[model samples]
Target: MRARNQLLDTDEPGRTVLTRHLPLPALHPVDYARGHAQFEARSDQRRRIVGWLDARLAEHPAEAPLSVLSVGCGTGAVDAPLAAAAAGRAVPGAVVRWTGIDPHGPSAAAFDAAVRHAAPDAEVVARACTFEALDTSDRFDVVTFVHSLYYVPDVLAALRRAVAMLSPGGRLLVLHAPLGALNELAATLAPETDGHPQWWSDTVIAELAGMGLRVHVEELDAEVDLTGCDSADRALLDFTVQAELTDEARPAVLEALRAAARPGGGLRLPHPVTAFTVRPR
Candidate 1:
């Protein structure tokens, strides 16, 4: 308890409390960052995204600078790696214009901090706004919604915006979790306010297809680490469910998490993420 309290109290400037409890939003960006750091699988996601980026960059002629926009760019964990890759030999003589957006102010600040260090050479801009309010006339060569479409008010509209904001021959990459066991637990424990099933890969795909966009999908396996996790630790559960929960609801949630544990039957979750790639000409 002391340790947890200590962590929450030390918020830097520009820090604010998390008010939205839709698809697993923490009350504090710092708390979200803590939970995010616990997931080793995100490292895998980062590697996969960076590898795909390098491949895409290779295909380009280096005719113009590469522009990348990251929607819901949290704390810069995923973008920093991609920025580093963009700065590498993938596209010689091509600069990477990095633009990131997140409604959370602190997360945006953290993103700017991370990007400054990771890809200092890249032209980076971090904004505290959602894609809907991006207010940008610039088009991007690559726009990514890495694990961020869940909380949007309208998933379909966001997808359309992502597609519309793309430069000619640009690609839109979306990494989202499917309807997995962990989400089922969350759905049972804390139903979303959206009055619909959470937006999984299928939801996004259906929307994209309706818009006549060509899309391809890839399955990526991951796990939500509840190792040494305390259900009493509200931040972890908040991130897991992407929402706020009552103390009364914690036990059932914790039990469900424990059931998915490994050989020891501890608190481990089997989380599979799907990657959606769309290239619109």
Candidate 2:
């Protein structure tokens, strides 16, 4: 199920609102650290994503000098590895460039910094703006929206724009771990209703293919161990909740979060991710 008409007026003129309702938990440092750690420890997922790109690039050897745009590239954890992989490829001086965009002020800065540290020779551009605000006429060899599609206000429109930015034979990749088991558990345990629109998967792919783009959808089984965490991290967890709720509703949501946390340390959480890849037709 896709979200309805929830567009906001942006400071930039003619820019469409990316998201109508923000999730309660605003992006935070702890979450960033946690995500970075996860990526570092679980390099296999990153390897898989890169391997998919390698196959695609190999199929189109004529399309050299890969230009990649990573939408919502939080902290550059994923981009660093991707850049390194591109650099190590056989294509010397192949011009591997990366542009990362994120609305979160600190995240954008941190990602840019990390990119510099991890891949010094790679050209990395970090923009602190909503994806909708990007108005580049140039196309890229690859465009990725990783784990950040759900936050966008208009999923279809965003997908359309991402596809438009892709050069011929270029690919657009969207990676996300939807609220599957987590949503179910949250719904069963909490009073506040939590449900995602079906359009998230079904409509997204249909719309992309309808545009004549070659689309591929892959659902991968993955799990994250959140065990041994206690209420002390309530404040950190609250940031995510606050992103989607009104300020007044935050306290109550925090209480719910506290209830959800395990007493000793952490809560075992299930993670399932879907990756959608599309080539411009």
Candidate 3:
């Protein structure tokens, strides 16, 4: 089954996001980590999410523990730090039940270790599976999909499922990369998507609006340090395009980076992400 595709392109202002196939094969988890590290302003994103989670914590006290479901929690690099932060925020006897699921077993295993180490008091279940594979009827106080929705088989279905899993007054938080200049070039150079659409934030937001849910949109700004970026920079390059580039694709990628070059003697690709916070019944 093709299993994955989304609505036509939704252009952001001042940038033309090419609606061709995204790079093939996607980035390996490790490469994704390295490339994401190049993002100059990720800490801002982390803080915003952690604050949102902290608010979720405030909704109840020790008597009523917060339930959190994290979809596509890979390696817990972004999540574990905040998980540790949550540990400190919890009242002396407060409890948090955290469930994280990712298809990559190794990454999930890593997440298990990190969260267990960081949030010792919280009940942690790190499973290696898709959102659908983790069978549970329990409602969550907060559910998040951080930059992982683009790879899901069905973004809208996953979003819907997350909302359904919410407890009353619960919030669903999603952070996804919006269509931008750097991604525009990558999309143009990449090979077949194998039927998987690299969904942008607008598509997901539109879906949520179609469902009649109120979504609070937050625009985030960041930069990818593409200084000296070249085809040989395999980890960052592969991550930038979400796939291994061809000989033909490399020069064009480099040219695109240069075109967006920073005034200071290197390339700084403007990478923006959008946060969608939805509170449903």
Q: All candidates' lDDT scores? A: 0.70, 0.60, 0.70
* Comparing 2 and 3 on lDDT, the stronger one: 3
> Which regions in candidate 1 have their CA more than 4 angstroms from the true location?
1-33, 39-64, 90-92, 191-197, 262-265
Residues 201-270 of candidate 1: C-alpha lDDT, one tens digit per residue: 7788788878877788888765555766562455666667655555655554565566556565556566
Error of 3 at 55 (Å): 6.3
lDDT of 2 by residue, 1-281 (tens): 43322222243454333232233334355564554454335234555555655565455453368788999887787777767666566265667677899887678888889877776767888898888887678788888887677656667788888888888878888876554534332222222213543234554666676677777888765544443223334433332332334445544444434444435655434455678888775
| Candidate 3: regions farther than 4 A off | 1-63, 191-194
Q: What's the lDDT for residue 66 in model 2?
A: 70
Candidate 3: which pairs clash? none
User: How do the predictions measure up, each by TM-score?
Assistant: 0.80, 0.69, 0.81
Model 1 residue-pair collision total = 5
Give the per-residue lDDT of model 3 (tens digit) for 113-206.
Answer: 9888888888899889987778888898888888778767677788888888899888898888777776665455444344665677877977
